[model samples]
Target: MAFTRRGILLGMGAAGGLIAAWALTPRQFAPPLHPGEGEYAFDAWLKIGKDGVVSVAVPDLEMGQGITTLIPQIVAMELGADWRQMAVEPAPVSGAYGNPVLAARWSQLWLPMLSGLADAPDGLLTRRMAENDAFVVTADGTSLAAHELAARAAAAGARAVLAQAAAAKWGVEWEECEAQDGFILHGRKRLPFAALLDAAADYSPPDPPVLRAMAPQERAADMPPGAQLHFVRLDLPSKVDGSHTFASDVRLPDMVHAAIRHGPIGAVRLGTFDAARAKGMPGFIKTVAGPHWLAAVADNWWSAEQALARIAPQFAVGDRADSKAIGAALRKALRSGAADRVATVGDPDTWLKSKFDHVALYTIAPALHAGVETASATARFENGRLELWAASQAPQALRLAAAAALDLAPGDVTFYPVAAGGSFDARLDSDHALEAALIAKDVGRPVQLTWSRWQEHLAGRPRAPSQAVLSARTAPDGSLVALGLRLAMPSSTRELGGRLFDQRSGKDALFLQSSSDRLAGEGLIPPYGIANLKIEHVPVEIGLPTTRMRGNSHAIGAFLVETFIDELAQRARREPLSYRMTMLAGDQRLAACLQRAATLAQWGGGGAGSGQGLACWKMQLDDRIGRIAVVASARRDDRGLRVDTLTAVVDIGRIVNVDIARQQIEGGLLFGMGLASGSSTSYAGGLPTTSRLGMLGLPQLADCPEVLVDFIEAGGEPFDPGELGAVVAPPAIANALFSAGSVRLHHLPLTAEQA
Candidate 1:
């Protein structure tokens, strides 16, 4: 049986509601691993594979997102076992491998609307209410997210089952033989998990074990930490080998190397080729319809690439929309754009007519997603089935797409993942996987399409270049009375493949689909106290759209909101830090973050060559708050301005790893700065300018700055940190530019004039 929900609401990360539609189950006692052996499954399974080693099958792609690191910790916490002795596996694709929390948050349009503080909106209340039923909890169901709830439920339930099995064997009451530390204990007699497994190997499994909910009051009194506990240790190492295998390091028997002369225009392909020129070349394969005029099948890649150099790629360029024409069109679209009411306040018409303060004009820069690893996928069609070796962040989507395209059952396709060189928000969606499948069909063997540095720059998914305008009206009391904001961003719906949202479905009985009514989110606004405020979002369609660049819309929105606050401080002749704190009167975390970042960056002191500045933001997802301070160091060189050091402070509530989280935050700042400074991508028509990495002028090791990361790891709450990398950089850097250059730069990719 199968159930479907077209579109679903989403929260922060993907959690419950997605189940793998595995066809394998214990009919009598055991089943094989695969088709003939038994059946194929995509279930999130925790197996103690006879070796006494615990392995959990998770579905998310590692792509340097820390999913592998975090999921097992949650499992360890719940299983009450060894965290260091467990192994993490990328669970197979099916209903079980889906990240449902991702679906729910997507349903909510990935809104980062500061939910932890007071005066939360109705939508949050509704979501929290939904969490209780869908999540694991006794009363009002939703407290912790689905993953956390699942761990506790699975652990507690399994304990009860073990206790019953022991009771049956010893002829005692289940309660009398209480389960303790992954074992059954009765009056000092104990049975370890492995021993119990051996004893009950042939028994039929019972309904998920019964468990008495640990209420708040009974936790300390009924069970102390040391009173009875068994901790799980994960069994895994860093898996490090000094020698590495990148996409560039691939080689296999009968494998062929290919080079593409890409389409000069968007939505166009290579229609013709120069085969006659390559007829005399060795190792030359037939010229295909695409960019590769001729593929060279050889024992190695170098020989093929060398032979390919002799062949000329036929230039059959299609209708071209030059960069100039595209930029003009988008700008014109912005000029006469219709205003939308994203935020409302006490009649903005009254405030616009009676504004007592000055106006603030700000513009953001266009940035590219120069992820270290370019798009690469290898596919092979063998026997009656197909196998794929891909490095993808959205692996589940790739599996579904490949199956649909190849006319094969989802099970017919197998996805093998490799360690990601690194992903900086560019691996979300594309026809790359599809393209790999296409080439492999023609070659009739495994083919690896490794994008060169140039190809990645020219065809890579770049962050949509965006712009914002801020206008503020102030009262005599030095407070913002009315504010107006107009922003532009790429259409978010383009990613959903025109699918509609449907929340009500029987997916829980089928593939564990999370119920959410939204699939695409756009135009998000936070609660800012200002009278007569008007905010609107324009669906600006520039060239190649890449919305999944790390922080998504939250990153862009934070930049605009935070920068406008800085503009207000300058206008009011108040310190930027103090001014922002005033706006966040009731928010202690936000207020504290602003203070901390300023204090760390020495906000009031003279900067490297300029002066001090402060920047801060509160992410709606997971209630993440971060602050930034940058001291720009620029010398009189013939070149443009360069920064010396960038410092940041963050408070992500409950952190799982201080080291990993800090590294990400610091890296994110540099990533953001790289875009702000050197990187470049643009729109040539409705299509985005996919610049290759080599052409992007993004920062390299030569220009890297010193970054310091400080964290506020509050022990009171347990929550995942929300988008930390790029959130604090813009505000902090913009402030630095203001101090160093005294220009209050509005646009990003800060020009020599702005810098």
Candidate 2:
């Protein structure tokens, strides 16, 4: 019989406190099996119990991507273990679990930039790079590849360790035994892994274990036979049964409730009213204030919120307060800013001057993550031992930040992972976690900090608004000639106050004290072999608080680039699909994806009054690159353009779970469509007015059309299926509108008036 241990479920009253202490404490936080107590340990990730149960811990957060299920599924496949007998949980914060892909990328980019290490020998620099292993996690859906590799390696290591233990127990040569499905096999008989558990006490793992290779025969044998055998979503049953634990479900003994009422984003401190009246409110506890924000703690959340409503705070406004002026500034910068050229193959100045081919300029407004669950955290500071339970995508980063805020060593802090309803970039900037820590430290008790919807809207960093001006020249014979694109946007790394080293002064400084220009553009520029091509970025500093969104810079840039490509095809009187195929000369992967989508959607053969449009995007995130294409069908009339159907084709290299991959594509498409057609968030007086759901005009069930997704398995390596839909949906919608005889959409959030 298979047995599973459920976590603590906090209900109410004194009994709940006792349950929390018994089941949710860190003493129970270790892996289900103890290393030295009748268990075989295989590194930090895998532990096999004497009872024949296998438990694995993964570092990836479970934010509805089904990572908890996927990680174990990968390990079980490699270990030849019974899937039904495995248990998985979140791993503790440690360097051993760091994502290799992210670590490699970060080391390559920032290691040599150190002041004293800039001139270091290549071998020493390489050694230093290998020592750093802190991987930054964001909700942008790019960590899948690295996590897959890491999980597989961990499983392989466990298999090797088990082989060694089995050899010793049977008194045979190591090569004389083969382990499969939790059993060690000798010539004609097999011994259960549990029988040799005691021998594992003296087993020492090999220096470098060989990982199973991805040969063609191995690939065919490993194909998941059904959903049950695949990387199935394991959290679904608990969620459906209403037994799953979210961050808000956590409760501790004598924990007070906290509510924060902070100034708007980028707002400077000015003044606040006296808290004398709030102190008199029912269930009032105490008030905590930071440099630019204040919080109230009470016996209940309602009392804390009620206490906050009685006070009025004032602050100095920021520079991007005027919505109209910010738009004007973006347009002006795109038109006249001195360009910092990124790539140029030949002289495009002379070609553009002599040709009257085609030019399109587009701009996108700012957008919010707009998560269902508002940001919240629970923290406690007791005698220099700080503990926090946060819905953080990057828990280690949050732990480090909290340690820094409390003037405590990192070892003094422990972060407990919790489930989040959603997190595009909300968890990336851990302001709420920091605030909770500070408030708990001051009050000398545990505090659960929550952000009101209004506060979440005002204080949260938004996707940076962007603008682009693309110009192209074509021959009269419909042949390509030259292309030029100038992209401009606020630097996200700089705006978020990233740490940097000043080369001139030999000192470290934040982005505020250094240049804002960055080489990090989100989407891969087009790979077409166009003559006289010039692509550049004009970095601008708009005094607005900005962070990465779902697609980051790629969403806006892809919108402009894809839409312009469609316009060029129209000007040349050629079919959009055919034009793209010609341009994708050597990119077989992208071409195949585009062709597959077109075939699935029946491109150029839509019924009367129905028009079709196609768009494709190639994304390079970390060490993985994948391509996605979308073909849309729509109709235009007095009711405006309505997208009736959408078909998407993806080449993500390798797929672990087809169901989960399809779901990600569907969700991302819906999210992008909501931003493209309905959203209208504006800023005024240094504050966003769309604080609630109704005002944001997000897309509803009625706005959704039929969506079909297809995946192409190239089968070598796997990339994430998270952000491709976000990159392909917006431009596909815009191109569909044009194909259906609507006016060109040069701006995002295609309003009815514009149509």
TM-score of each: 0.76, 0.87
**Candidate 1: C-alpha RMSD after superposition:** 9.1
Error of 2 at 480 (Å): 3.1
For candidate 2, give the lDDT. 0.68
Each candidate's number of clashing pairs is 64, 0
Candidate 2 TM-score to native: 0.87
**Compared with the true structure, what per-residue lDDT tens digits does model 1 show for residues 490-590?**
54433332211222111111111111112112323543456577776655544343444656665666666666777776676766666666667666765
Top-lDDT structure, candidate number: 2
Query: Which candidate comes out best when scored by TM-score?
Result: 2
lDDT value for model 1: 0.50
Error of 2 at 454 (Å): 1.6
RMSD of each: 9.1, 7.6
What lDDT score belongs to each candidate, Candidate 1 first? 0.50, 0.68
